[model samples]
Target: MVKLTLIRGLPGSGKSTLANTIDAVHLEADMYFVNQQGEYCYQPDKIAQAHQWCQQQTEQQLALGHDVVVANTFVQQWEMQAYRDLANKYQAELEIVCCNGQYSNVHGVSALTIANMRAKWQD
Candidate 1:
């Protein structure tokens, strides 16, 4: 049996950090922001593609009988629902963690933007 962990938080939140501590196959779309020079580069037009890649990776890892962890800014329940479906499809145990700690610079996300995201976070 496999397990899937969905770690959600704002841009500066420690979602990725927490995912690392869990000893799972961590996946984060922000990784897509990285450029060939190993620098972070945010591309507005590629957000959907980044997410699609993450989803595909999750499925592949699950099919290989490995546990997975997804770290993303899932401020709304709907944003994380697809992972739930994937977990069910693979009969994998699913877990969700909401990281609320205030962090900055780790992803080059500004404090103001993180605050704005917090304000819009769904309950």
Candidate 2:
């Protein structure tokens, strides 16, 4: 069966790590910031664009009938709406995985940013 797994967590959590371990096409909004030199350059102004790219990539993979794993800080439920809709459209089994492990995030997100996300986090 086709599957789409979404890993959600705050920065420093194990979302990306868990997503990597899954046998599927791994995707994340953070990926949109990675330059050709294999470096991550985060631009706050492009955050929404990054998310749109991620969603489009997910839809493309689903269209090709590939299982996909997307890791993002979906702190609020609304952030996941697009993925949920994609899963439905593709008739893929959808799974939401929450990772709360305290592993150091590769992107070096600030504690303040993490705190703000935690404040608005939903179950």
Best by lDDT: 2
Winner by TM-score: 2
Give the per-residue lDDT digits (tens) of candidate 2, residues 1-123: 689999999998899888989999999999999999999999999999999999999999999999999999999999999999999999999999999999888998898988999999999
Please identify model 1 stretches exceeding 4 Å from their true place: none
Return the number of clashes found in candidate 2: 0
- Estimate, for each residue in 1-123, the C-alpha lDDT of model 1 and write its tens digit: 899999998876788788889988989888888889999888989999999889999999999999999999998889888899999999999988888887664767677877787888996
Candidate models: Cα lDDT each: 0.88, 0.96
